[model samples]
Target: MHMTDVLAAADISKAVAAFAAADSFNHKQFFVMCGLKAKSKDDMKKVFHILDKDQSGFIEQEELCLILKGFTPEGRNLSDKETTALLAAGDKDGDGKIGIDEFVTLVSES
Candidate 1:
């Protein structure tokens, strides 16, 4: 499944507006607003795959910086601090990248 199939353009716009208004990246709120919180584990895996742009089997910090763009063309890049926080949250094994299982767990728990 493709990202556009999961999150529509309207949803991406709404998320962008919210982020602009707040001037900060709220991971949980963004997920909730984008309907990601209700997605099944399998769906989340699909999302992880989509985000893993290099097919590296993991999401590295550099990719995390551009993660929002994976959702939409107009989505902004994450700030360095936001990227670091997100990576720290999901890189549970301390390998400095987020593996599939860790990605699922991080999103699920959020």
Candidate 2:
């Protein structure tokens, strides 16, 4: 990988490690740790796209469960309970998954 890619990967690994030790899942703090504190709706949308691994325009529970792995190959998977809670928080429309708009709002407001 390029130097910048390697550096970013290292940063993400540290962030993921810190997040894994937190008592509760705090989406806003997690995002900030990952250097994903969006300065605009468009920036937030990009982050949502990254998390939406299937490119289905939504973040399913399965995707959320493995969200940390998106940052680094060694990142641990989120527990079932954590995944469900995160889904419920972002799935504002009672949908089983988080759409782009919901994702943006969830991160922006938190």
Candidate 3:
């Protein structure tokens, strides 16, 4: 999804308030919350590209699942139910997948 989608989905007031309570916001937190990680900006872009499997710049349900699986360490995978709930909570569009917009919105709420 386009970065503008994030602003559209987010509660700006809430995000600003939450931002105040944090020590800082960083790539690590952004990735972890979105169920991703990378060692550098380039690496992070790689992860984003992988998640955007269709090159549509929007991550569909299947891609979201794949991305989460890629990040989850061996033997530490989330239970089916847990994963389901997470998706349910974050998939704001009710489209069964989470685009970057939805992910940013969800994390901002948290």
Candidate 4:
């Protein structure tokens, strides 16, 4: 299945899942899963590419919302309060935009 399909099917922490599968995804297994090959840097780039659908070199609000949908893979959707909090925390410019850098930073910090 596609990664996003795996994500949507999950009912737990994606971080936990990814970490648990780290051995496989770290360098080798990702190739097997995706039918492609790449170095670590390339892999990271692909992830960011997937996150930046608009190809604006930055993630926007809609992109962020899609990402937030996957944050809690436990099938426990975020409450309105939680969503608001997430936007507030990551919307650095406060122009109602959360760029890819901001999202990446927020996810990394979390």
Candidate 5:
């Protein structure tokens, strides 16, 4: 179903407020919530490109850490330990980095 179909006009304010208050918003959740996937893969691709700061095909340690900063309400950065753990969880290829495929896989499954 479309996002609009799922969300009433009256519920929009609350949904947006909740989204804004969230510490972190993942791609799959976003796509599903906004019905972007129902439209096309382009939205996901755009989000990925935006997160890929250096335009590198892969997301490296620093990039992940930088992004994690937005994952907390306090604007706190991810510690090295936290970053490593995140990598361990998301880097499926053992390549020490997260590729687009891995990224999509992580979010889609979550």
Candidate 6:
């Protein structure tokens, strides 16, 4: 399975705005640095699911900070401003949150 398969199980393109947390996503590193070995798409999705804390099928801003925690050695969350950029970096729909597709594509492409 791939990240696409995992995200495909979710609803597509639901507009959600705002995420709450404070840290940064280092563009220098790989997306799987977020606790995902993610050589395969399914692996990426698993990481996505792990980040989607509310289980709303969307990885909200707060959740994204938590995800960033794993990506860092200090296990620190992202700053709210930085988190917004992370969302914007891949939020193709401008929903303010990272949907499955956005996340999968972001990681897969990288």
Q: What TM-score do all the candidates reach, one by one?
A: 0.90, 0.80, 0.43, 0.43, 0.57, 0.65
lDDT at residue 19 of model 6 (Cα atoms): 18
Model 2 lDDT, residue 62, Cα: 89
- lDDT string for model 1 (47-101, tens) is 8899899999999998998878887767888888899888888898999999999
- Model 1 lowest lDDT segment of ten: 14-23
Question: What is the overall TM-score of model 3 with all chains considered together?
Answer: 0.43
Better of 1 and 2 by lDDT: 1
lDDT of 4 by residue, 1-110 (tens): 23453233242244334424212222123222332232243443455566566778765556544542333333233344444555677677786666656655544444
What is the C-alpha local distance difference test score of candidate 6? 0.56
For model 6, name the residue pairs that clash: 2-41, 2-42, 3-41, 3-42, 19-61, 22-78, 22-79, 23-78, 23-79
- Write down the worst ten-residue block by lDDT for model 2: 1-10
Model 5 scores a C-alpha lDDT of 0.55
How large is the C-alpha RMSD of every model relative to the true structure? 1.7, 3.5, 11.6, 9.4, 7.1, 10.0
Put down candidate 5 lDDT per residue, 1-110, tens digits, no spaces. 22234334344333333345334434345445544344434544554555577889877898876543322223334567656766676799899998887766655664
lDDT of 6 by residue, 31-90 (tens): 433223345767666767766767788887778766534332234566776767677776
Instruction: Give residue 17's lDDT in candidate 2 (0 to 100).
Output: 83
RMSD of 4: 9.4
For all candidates in order, the CA lDDT equals 0.82, 0.74, 0.46, 0.45, 0.55, 0.56
Sort by lDDT, best first: 1, 2, 6, 5, 3, 4
State the lDDT at 96 in candidate 4. 68
Provide backbone clash counts, one per model: 0, 0, 1, 2, 0, 9
* Candidate 5 residue pairs that clash: none
lDDT of 3 by residue, 33-88 (tens): 44333133444455555557687766665554444333322212334554565678
Judged by lDDT, which candidate is best?
1
Order the candidates by TM-score, highest first: 1, 2, 6, 5, 4, 3
For model 4, where is the 10-residue window of minimal lDDT?
Answer: 21-30
